[model samples]
Structure formats: C-alpha cells, structure tokens
Target chain A: MIWAVALSAGALVASGAYLALSRDALRAVVGVSLIGAGANLVVLSAGRLDAVMPAFVPEGASRLADGAANPLPQALVLTAIVIGFSLTCFALALVMTIRQRVGDTDSTGLRAAEPPAGADGLPAFPDDER
Target chain B: MNADLTSLVVVAPLLVPLAAAVASTVSAGRPRVQQAIGLGGAILLLGSALVLARAVAAAGQVRTALGGWDAPFAIEFVADGVGASLVVLAAVMGLTALLFQQDDTDPAPASPAFVPLVHAFLAGACGAFLTGDLFNLYVWFEVVLIASLGLLVLGKERRHLDGALTYFVLNVVGTLFVLVGVALVYAATGHLNYVAIAHATMADPYRVLPFVAVLSVGFLVKAGAFPLFAWLPATYHTLPAPALALFAALGTKVGVYALLRTGGAVFPTVAPLMSDLLGWVAVGTMVTGVLGAAYHWDIRRILAFHSISQVGYILLGIALGTPGGAQGALVFALHHSLVKGSLFLIAALVCREAGSYDLRHIGGLSSARPWLAALFLLQALSLVGIPPLSGFWAKFLVVRETLVLGHVVWAATALAVGALTLYSMLKIWLEAFWRAHPREDWQPPPGARPASAIAAAGLAAVTTAFGLWPEPVLRFTFMAATVLHTRP
Candidate 1:
C-alpha cells in the first residue's frame, strides 16, 4: 500500500511538472493544481497507512490506541489542501484574466510588462514614442 | 515582564497588522477611513515591535505556545533577537510604505483592497518571523503569497496581470516545494517544531539533509537567488512604487531570514555540509543579479536585480556557518531593506517629476529637483557601499566574515559584486539625474507631494545614522548572532 501511494504521488508530480512547463497558461495552471494534489497526497502518506483504526482515544483513555492512525499528518494535509486550492483558484483566475486582456493564453505571449528590445537593444518603453 | 504580558508582546507584532487588515477590509470602500486605519495600525505595529524587541532583549528569547498547549504539540511563536529585529524591520517598512503612498496621485484607479492587502502582507511577514514551528512558517509564507498576489493585480492592467501570472506560477511552485519539504521533515523526525526537530535529528543529522535540500530550494526561489529568480525582475517592475518598495524591503529578506534561522540555528550540524554549496550559490546570485542589473534600463528592474545581488551577500554570510557570519547577515539584511526600500521610494519621486520609470525617457532631475537629486545621490552612494553609510558597514561585516572563514574566492566575488553594484547605481545617477530629459520641453509635474520625499529622506537619515554610530546596532546584531548560534 505504501509503495502504491508513493508511486502514484511520484507519477502525479512528474506529469504535473511536465504540464507546468508547457507554454499554454491554462495547462500550466492545471499542472500547478496537479502538483499540489500530489504534494497533498505525499503529506497524507507521511503518517503510516498500515493502521486501519481511526485516530481516536477510547472513552477511558488518556491517549490514542497503539494501532490508531497518526492524526498530525492528516491535519497538515488538510491545511495544505485548503491553501493549495485557493492558490490554484487564484492561478486559474489569473490565467483567465490574461486570456481576456492579452487576447491569448500563451505564457510567452504575455509580455506586456516586458516589451521587446528596440533598435538600440534596450526595452522599448511603451510611452516613449509619445 | 509578566508571563501573560510577555505572551501578548510576543504575538503583538503579528496581531496588530492582522487586526488592521480586518478593520481595513471592513471599511473597504471608504479609502480615507481605510488609510487612517492602516496608518494607525502601522504606528501601533511599530510600537508593538519596539516593545517586543525590548522584551526579547530583556529575555534572550520570548516564546509562547498557543492555546496553552505544550512545546512539541502546540504551535509556537518565538521571538529571539533575530526574529524580533526582523519584526521591527517589517514594521518600519510598513510605516514607510504607507507614508510613501499617502499623497501620491497615480492615473491608475487605486484599488480599495490595497491597504488591507498591505496589512495582510505585513501580518504574514511578522508571522513567518515569529513562528517556531516549520509548518506554521509554511502557512505564513502562503499568507504572504496570497496578499502579494492580490496587491500585484490591483491595477487590473494587462501588464499587471502579466507580471502577476509569472509571480503566481513561480511562487506557488516554490510554496509546494516547501510543503513537501515540511512533510518530509515531519516524516523523518516526527516533529514540526524547530527545537524538537533539532533534538530529534541530533544523533544523525545527515538523515535530515535531503529534506533540508528541498526546503532550501523553496527558500532560494523566494530569496530570488541565481537561476531561480526570473520571477522577481519579470514581475516587480509592474507594481506601483510604494507597493514595490514594501515588497522590495521585506519579501526576499524573509526567505534569507528563513535560511538563517533553519540552517544557522536549528540544524547547525548540517551547516558544514551545506556551507560550500550555499557559498557557490551566493557567488552565482551575486554575479547573475549584478549582470542582470547592468542589462536593464528601467530603474525598477535595475533595483530589482540589485535586490537579488544583495541577497547574495547576506547568503554568503549565512553560508559561512559562524556566529560572526550570522551577525553580518543580520546587519546586512536590515541595512539593505532600508536602503533598497528608500531607493525605490526615491525612484517613485523621480517618476513623478520626470514622467517615466525608463531611465532613457526620463532625466534632468539634477537640474530641476536638486533635493530629490541629493536624496537619490545619498541613497545611490550608500547602496554602492560608500563610507559612513549603512551599506558600507553591512558589506564590511559580511565580506570580513567571508575572509575570516578563508573563502577567498567567495570574498572576492562579493567585493566585485559591490563594484558592479556601484556601476548600476551610477547608471541610475548618470541617466536619471545627470543627463537632460529626453523630451526637450519637459517640465516637473505640478502639485508633486513632499510626503514621499519625506519618507525617503527619513530612511536615508536612518541609514546614515546607523553607519556613523554603528555600535548599538552592532551590539544588538552580535547578541542576535550569539542567540542564533546557541542551540535552544
């Protein structure tokens, strides 16, 4: 079970990285989301998965049972998932904005902040001609 | 201080900005009310920071476990001398940014969300500095990331979106790397608290090296170190000058601070192994950043690149893995934050008078606005490490530590970077102030406010004072270094 989880997480991250390196903005955003999911899985797996029991203290006990699952990684994964979700939402919204304003989704094409070099090789200041 | 009061003081640097963020958000549409709240919050934050600094000085470190949970389990906030000083720096930058923004009139429609986001950014920076738990640090980094992203896209311009996209993608990737690093560290040691992790890994420190490697990548990206800093220059120029100033001051320094806290303080055993690698990274960062600055004509881009180069100096100090090196890194971080921040604020004034951020399109400031010229020259010279200015002392400390450690090539690279830094500053000086305006009939803009100039001048004054009377600051940083170098 641990090997399966590890292999799946690795594959997710590898594919995510490849997609994230793509030129298309939308794909890159999806890639980010994929990578985030992979990370979340990795965090979840940090606590051993061998235990089948829930992380609970019995009615009379001061501590959780020996075979109970580790709860800390679950808590950490919960936090990472929420933060990662919001970040992906922001990235997607940004990609949408770029597509709307710049009229394309190509990351390379979004060069409004970095105008191409002019005749003298300096960045052509947009308002210079005015 | 009493225990309850001490706990409150320990958390105040974080809470003041957070409360301000909430209040500003509630008063969103009323820009005037929001600005007043923001200013009030900034002042209160500074007061809190000073108080915390005092408390930390009184006690070598002040710590509190939230919700009364004990150390290993509960999230902890600890302000040692290093963290306390950084909190103070954040407060100063927060106030300066607000003052710089006070009377500026930009043609772009100002976002009502700006003040709230600035406060959020401050809260995040303070939280990151104060937290003793590794996972908490990651959470604070996200807070900073989200707030800065909001600030970046406030203008809603195409350029703003462009820059924000690059920033978002790169920084989110870095954050994920950090998340993985945190998970791996926890798996290795079954601990998230710095002190706990240190104790857990003490027997076989090399067991934590792979996890630390992942963590350092995330931080290096945040610090805008070489080969991982494309996001910085690509995006920072898109910010309004005041926002740029705030980001310039606190953003990358947070990353450097994390490296110092973790490598220098928590995992001292691993420093020897990582020192050589970090030394080379510092050299690359210095050379790459200065070269990038040389290739840029836009004042903001030039300053952004220089920010990276200066981070190299601080990293070199950390890479030395000694108490003296930590001291140098702390002083340089504080000095660079003030000087570089003021330089950006001054650049904003230059833009106001000369009508462009591109140096080629703007000039003649030396003749028209001599005071601004003087301010620019003061900061520019200080940035280049001229004597009796803060930058000189900062560079001296770091380079001295490098030589002491016998890293001759690294020390040489640092000195050479300082020379190239001078070249960049001179480029700004000669082009923006010395040459005539590109437009023959250009005139200084009307109704230009003195508030921004006053803010810049205030920073310049602090830098000058720090240089002239370096004893107190040096002593404080020395204490900080000793505290950091000593294991908890």
Candidate 2:
C-alpha cells in the first residue's frame, strides 16, 4: 500500500514539474490536473488499505478496526476532484481566448505582450510620430 | 444571543455576496439592476461585519460546528476577534470598490460577467476567513482564483489579457501547492479540521514537516510574499481601475491573514522560526519592490511595484510573533487596505482627468483639479506615514514592536523602506501632477465622469476619518492580537 501511494505521488510530482516548465499552455493545464489527481490518491491511500468491506461495518465493529478504509479521505477526494475540474475548465477557456486573440499558444509568445520595461513617458502626437 | 450570532456573522458574509452575485448574473442584461444588486449586497456584508465585530468583542470567542457535524467530523465556523475583524475589512473594501464600479462611465458595456465574479470573490474572502477546515480553505482559495481571473480579464484589453494570464498561471501553481499540503495533512492525521489537525500535530510533531512546508508555500504565494510574488505587479497594474483597487485592498491581505491564523493556531511551535524567515523575506520584498518602483515612470506600475514593497512590512510585523508584533501587523494590514485602496482610486481619478497614467504624458493637473489633487495628496501622505494619518500610526506601531523585540536591524530596515516609499510617492507627484500640461488634443478619455472623481474623494475621506480616529481600529486590532496570542 505504501509503495502504491509513493508511486502515485512520484508520478504526480514529475508530471507537475514537467507541466510547470512546459511552454505549451494546454500541457501545463494537463500537468496541473495530473498533480491534483495524484494528490487525491495519496490522501485516499493514507487510510488503512485492508478494509475487508466498505466502511459500513456491522454492529460492534470497532471504530478503529485495523482493516476499515477511512471515509474521510474519500470525502476529501470528491471535493478535490470537483474543484480541480472547474479550474481546468476555466484555464482551458482562458487558453482558448489567448490562442484566438494573441495568435499563439506558447508561453514565450505570451511574454511578447508585456509592455517594455519603463516605457512610461508622454503619448506621442500623431504629427510627431512621422 | 451574541454567541448564537457567531454563526450568523460567519455565514451571512459569505451568503450575502453569493446571493447578490447570483442575482447580478441573472440581471446582467440590465446594467443598472446589476449595479444595484451588487452594491446592495456589498453594503449589507459590510454592515453585517461591523455587527459581528461588536458581538465578537463582547463575547471573546465563538464556534459553531457547521451542519452540526461536531468538531472533527463537521466543518466549523469559528469567530474569534481576529476573524471577525477581517470580515469587517473585506466588507468595507468590497463596498468601497463597488462605489467606484458604479460610477465608471466607460461606454464599454458592462461585462456580462462582472457582478457575479465580484460576488464570488467576496464570498471566497469571507469563506477563507471563517472556515475551520484546512481543505475547506483550499476550496475557498480556488473560488477566489476563479472569480478574480474572470473579473481580471472581463474587459478583454491587451494589457488585461497579459496580466490575467500571468496571474492565472501563478495562482494555479499556488493552489496546487496548497492541495499537496492538504493531502499530506490529511494523511498524517485522519482529520481535516484545523482544530483536530492542531491536536494531531501536537501529538506527532515530527510527522507533519512535509505538510507544513507545502501549506506555507501555497499561502505565501497567495499573499504575494517575497520570492513568490513575481505575478503581482504585472497583473495588478493591468486590471481596470476599480478592480485594481479591490485587488490592492484585499488580495495579499487574505494570504497574510491565512499565514497568521495557521502560524498562530495550528502550528505555534514553528512560528518563531517561520516568522524570522518571514522577516527576512519582508526586507527583501520591500527593497526589491522599491527598486522596481524607482525604475518605473508609469504611475500605475510604480504603485503596483510599491504594493509588493508595502506587503513586506506587514509580513515583518507578523514575523515577530510577539503580541506587540501581531498587534502592529493587524494595524498595518488594515491601514494598508484603506490607504492603498484610496491611492489606487486616486490613480484612477488621475487617469480620468489626465488622458494617461504614464507619468511623462500627465502634467499640471493640480491647478486644473485642486480637489482631485487634494485627495491624491491625502492618500499619498497617508501612505508615506505622514503625521496624524492612519499610515503613520501603523508604521509607528510596527517600528515600536520591532524595537521592543530588540531587532534593531529590522527596525532600521523598515524605517528605511518608509523613506523609500516617500521617494516613490514624490516621484508620482512630480511627474504626474506638477509637470507642464500636454497638448490641447491630449485630454482624459471622454466619459470620464465627475462621479468617479467623487468616488476617489470619498475613499480619501474614509482614509482620513480612520487616521483621525484610529481608536476604534486600534481597539479591534488589540482584541484580535489578544485572541491570537492567548492559547486556549
């Protein structure tokens, strides 16, 4: 169980780092989604993995029974998934708009939109510009 | 009645803004109706916050387990003095920003998205303040990020687009870190509620290091602390005037509040070292931000860089971890919100009268618009810690507290930062207002209304009002500090 948890966390972290460093905006979004998924799995897997059945135990079942899967993580995972999904959707929409207007999806291209450092003087007159 | 009122105070601040947001979304086709509903909701939240602060002050502390779920199992709405005070701050800033929004005469039709987005951000701020569950806090953070992103890009300007994209990416990274922290905390202890996690950590302090590190990174990014605040200046400068003021007023403060809550309550033992780290970061943030401001000639960008610098001082106050430090931090936080909000609004007023926020293009507006200049001077001096203004008192408190701790270096650094702040303020004044007027063709954008100028003046008045009679804010700040400093 520990091995499984560690593997998921490792994959999540790797994907997250890759996505963070990626130039493609869409891939970065995907990376974040993967990271969220991995974090959820790590949380859910932390509980006892040997539950003989679902958490609904019969009468007299010890609350701390060794094999019972903790329900808390399950609840938490559901919340995380919903929030993660919404964020991805919003991020994707933003990426779409950027592609439509800015004519590029690369993060490098996006940097071109930034104003020149300290280019803050008077607006030039139309006649002066020529 | 006061104790029972705690839940009402906590829930109403969140619900009112949400309900207003929903109503505004439905009525977005009608700009007037949308403004009415949104402004009404904000005003109510502010009123509710004041009442809540009063009740919390009389009662000391109050907790209501949400949905009757009991401490560990159910979510909680805990209102001690600190939480209540922040609610009031958020509400006031929300209403003030709404006033600016209402008066904006840009023929650019109101976004189909603005009112609802503001509503969501308001709810998220209140939710972040009131929630007792660590994961619940994460939920609110995402809510705020979504709402803010939507609002940030509503106008679809070239600059807004650029700022929003950068802001979005950085915040998403911050949220991911928070998720990692929450997951680890849940794993280390089977509890997600803050109180329960506090208990769990008390029993097994050695096991929670990874979780703590993850959580701190997330909150620090949101708060725009040193090293992680790369997105703030670019993004904040691009937001439209009212939205910019709101961001300046609330965004980083939320992160600071979260840090304070977590550092003081759930992880008290590690706070001294964490605060020391925060103190160093504050110094770095201040110096870097001020240097950036010096390099910029655009009025808006200069102010934007200074926001990053001023945030450092608040962090310094919190880093001390002493009661005096917390008190000073609270005072500084509230003072910054008003003065910063006012200052940003003043910039908007300048943009209204002067055609541009670029310092070189703007000039001689003081003679043309003395009232606007008066408002600008008031907020600027307040921000620079001029005597009898709110900013001065806040700086005095932070400096005194640092000296009390015998941290002469931090005290001196903070004082030096204050002087640098003055330099930047003077830079704006000289270039934007005192320079010779531009060509006759160069004028403020048409439809820049007197209403917005009045709104700017109104905000300036509020800043002065607080400065003149800070006893009320000071009392609340003291109560909040006492609550945090005293362990139950």
Candidate 3:
C-alpha cells in the first residue's frame, strides 16, 4: 500500500512537471494543481500506514492505543488541501483575466511589458533612424 | 501591562494589518474609510513593533503559543531580535507605502480595494517574520501571493494581466516546493517547530541536509536569486510607482528573512555543501542581475534588475556564515529595503514628470525639479556604494567579510557589480534628469500629487540616517547575528 501510494505521488509530480512546460496558461494551472495534489499525498503518506485503529482515545483515557495512526500528517494534509484550493482559485482567475485580455491562453503573445530584442526591433525609440 | 498583553504586542504586527484588511472589506465602497483604517492601523502597528523589538532586546526571545499547548504541538510564534527588528522594518515600510498610496491617484473610480490589498500584503510580511512554524510561513506566503497579485492585476490592462499571471504561477510553484521540503523534514524529524527541529537536525545532520537544501532552493527562488529571478523584473515593472515601491521594500526581503531564519538555524546540517552551493550561486546571481540591469533602458526595469542584484549581496553574506558575514547581510538588507524602495518611488515620480520611463526620451529634470533630482542622485550614489552612504557601509562589511573568508573571486565579483550598479544609476541620472527634457514642455500626469515626493524623500532620509549613524543598525544586526547561534 505504501509503495503504491508513493509511486502514484511520484507519477503525479512527474506528469505535473511535464504539463507545466506547455504554453497554455490553463495547462500550467492544472499542472500546479496536480503538483499540489501530489504534495498532499506525499504529506499524507509520510505518516505510518500500518494501523488497526483510528486516531482516538476513549473518554477518561490518558493515552492512545499503541497501534494508532500518526494524526499529524492527516491534519497537515487537510491544511494543504484548503491552501492549495485557494491558490488554484487565484491561478485560475489570473488565467481567466489573461484570456479576457489577450483573447488567447497562449503565453507567447504576452510580451507587452518587456522590451523587444535589439536585433528584432528597429530601435528602442521611434525617432532613431535605423 | 501583563504577560498576555506583552504577548499580544508581539503578535500585533500581524493582527493590526489583518484587522485593517478585514475592516476595509466591510467599508469596501469608501476609499477614505479604507485609507483611514490602513494608515491608523499602521501607526498602531509601528508602535507595537517598537515595543516588540524592545521586549525581544530585553529578553533573549519571546514565544507566544496559542491554546496553551506545548510549542511543537500548537500554533506558535517566536520573535528574536531578527524577527522583531524585521517587524519594525515592515511597519515602517507599511506606513510609508500608505503615505505614497494617499498621493497615488488612479484614473478609475476610487476603489477601497487598494488599501485592503496593501494591508493584506503587510499582514503576510509581518506574519511570516514572526511565525515559528514552517507551515505557518507557507500560509503567509499564500496571503502575500494572493494580495500582491490582486494588487498587480488591479488594472485591466493586458500587460498587467501578463505580469501578474507570471508572478502568480511561479510563486505558487515555489510555495509548493517549500511544502514538499517541509513535509519531508517533518517526516524525518517528527517536529515542525524551529527549536525542536534544531535539536533533531543536530542529532542527524545527514538526514536533514537534503530536505533543508530543498527548502533553501525554494527560498532562493522566492528571493529572486540567479536562474529564477526573471519573474521579478518581469512583473515588478508592471506595478504602479507606489505599489512597486511597497513591493520593492517588502517582497523579496520577506523571502530573505525566511532564508536567514531557516538557513541560519540549520547551518549545521547545511555546512558541508553550503560553500560550493551558495558561493557560486551568489556570484552568478550578482553577475547575471547586474548584466540584466546594464542591458535595460526602461527606468523601472533597471531598478527591478538592480533589486535582484542587491539581493545577491545579502545572500553572499549569508552564504559566508560568520558573525561579520551575518551582520553584513542584516545591515545590507535594512539599507536595501529603504534604498531600493525609495529608488523605485523616485522612478515613478520621474516617469510621471517626464512623461516617459524610457531613458531615450526623458531628460533635463535637474534644471527644473532640482530637489527631486538631488534625491535621485543621493539615493542612486548610495545604491552604488559611494562613500558615507548607507550602501557603502553595507558593501564594506559584506566585502570585508567575504575577503576575510578567502572567497577572492566573490569579493571581486561583488566589487565589480558595484561599479556596474553605479553605471546603471548614472545612465538613469544622465538620461532621466540631466541630459535634456525629452520634450521642452513636459507636464506631470493628471492627478499626480506632491505627497509621493515627500514620502519618498522621507524614506531616503531614513536611509541617509542609517549611513550617518551606523552604530545602532550595526548593533542591531550584530545582535540578530548572534541570536542565530555563535558558530554552533
């Protein structure tokens, strides 16, 4: 079970890296989301898996059973889920705006803020006689 | 008045900004109300920060654990001289950014969103500085990422979206990288608290080394170090003058602070590879950043590149790992925040007054706005590490320590970068202010106010003050350096 989970997490991360190399903003966003899911899995798997009982203690009991699961990773994974969700929402909204602005999701056309290369342009200025 | 009150003061830098942000949301339609909340909360925050610094000074460290649980098991905050002094720095930047925001007028209808976003950025900055938990730092980074992107994309312009998107995507990925490292470390060490982790790392240095290195790379990306800093120059140039100034002051330095807190705390685990890893990285970062700056003609882009270059100096000091090295890093960071922030703010004003940030067009501002010209020259020369300026002392300490550590190549690269930095600054000076007004009758942008000049000059004056009376800041940095532990 641990091996299966670890392999899947590794797969998710590898695929996410592959997807993140594309120019489509949506794909990039999905790539990040996949990475986030992989991260959550990694965190969840960090805890021990051989557990016969849930993480709990009866009323008036001072300690948990010896074979109980490590609960910290569960809590940490839950936090990551919520944080990752918000981050995805932000990234999606940014892509939405990017689409609305440029009318395309491709990042190739989004160079308005950067200056053109000296070789590709006439000059940096209009008055220069090239 | 009591322990609880004192603890509250320690957390107030985080609270005041968060509260202002929440309150501003309620009064979302009224810019004035939002402004009042931002400015008022910042003043209170500044006061609390001063108290926190004093408390941390009088004591060794201040820890605040919520819900009364043991530290590693509960939500916790710890502040030493480094964190507390950082709080003071954030508050100062917050207030000055607020001042600039007052004069910052946009063409669109007055939206309360600006102040709330600014408040949120401050909240994240202050929280990240104070939090002891690695997970909590990730939360604060998210807070900063969302709000700062919200600020960046406030304009519906295509360029704004482009820049904001790039910034958002890259930073979220960086945050996830940090999370992976944090989780792996937790898996190995069974603790998330700094104190606990320090103990664990000491027991098994080899186990902690790889994870800590991953975390360091995560922070280096966020800090805009070499090979990952393209996004900074890309997005930062898109912000308005005032907002750029705010981010210029607080953004990358927050990452630097995290690097210091985490890197310095785990120096033992990271030592074997630190020199080879960070030394070359620092040199490449400084050289690449300066080279980028030297190629840029747009004033904002130049300063953005300079920001990346300046971060290299700080990282070099950190990579050196000596008392003098750490002192130099802290002092340089403090000076860079004010100097870089003031420089960007000055760029905004110059862009407005000259009708262009393109150096090819704008000129002869010295003949008219001599005071603004003088402000630019002073800040620019200071950035160049000219004598008797804050940057000079910062560079002196850093280079002296680097040479002492026998990294002659790094020392030479740093000095050479200083010369290039001066050349870039002079390029701005010659074109933007000295040569000739690009057009004979340039006018300031409509709704441009004089308050930005006053606010910028105020920050510049503080930077100058650091230069003139270097003792107090030097002492503070030395204290901060010692707090990280004396050579393990």
- Best candidate according to lDDT: 1
- lDDT preference between candidates 1 and 3, better one: 1
Please give, for residues B1-488, the per-residue lDDT of candidate 2 as tens digits: 75456677668878899899899989989988888898899989988887777778887766788776667888887777778887887887788777776665322335768778877988898888888888888888888888898877776655556667788778888887887788877777777787777777775566786678788889889988889998887677666677777788888888888888878777666566567777898889878888888878777778878988888888888888877788888888888888888788788767657766778778787777777777788899999899899899999999999998898999999889889989999988887777767675565455546666666677778779889998988887887888877765
Cα displacement (angstroms), candidate 3, residue B300, comes to 0.7
Worst 10 residues of 1 chain A by lDDT: A119-128
- Candidate with top TM-score is 1
For candidate 1, lDDT tens digit of each residue in B296-415? 888888999889999999999999999999999999999999999999888877877888777878899999999999998988888889998888899999999899879899999999
- Which prediction has more favorable DockQ, 2 or 3? 3
Error of 2 at B246 (Å): 0.8
lDDT of 2 at B92: 79
Instruction: Provide chain B's TM-score, model 3.
Output: 0.96
> Between 1 and 3, whose TM-score is larger?
1
DockQ comparisons of all candidates to the true complex: 0.47, 0.36, 0.37
Q: How many residue pairs in model 2 have overlapping backbones?
A: 1
Q: Give candidate 3 regions above 4 Å deviation.
A: A115-130, B104-109, B441-448, B486-488
Docking class of 2: acceptable
- Report the TM-score for the A-chain of model 2: 0.77
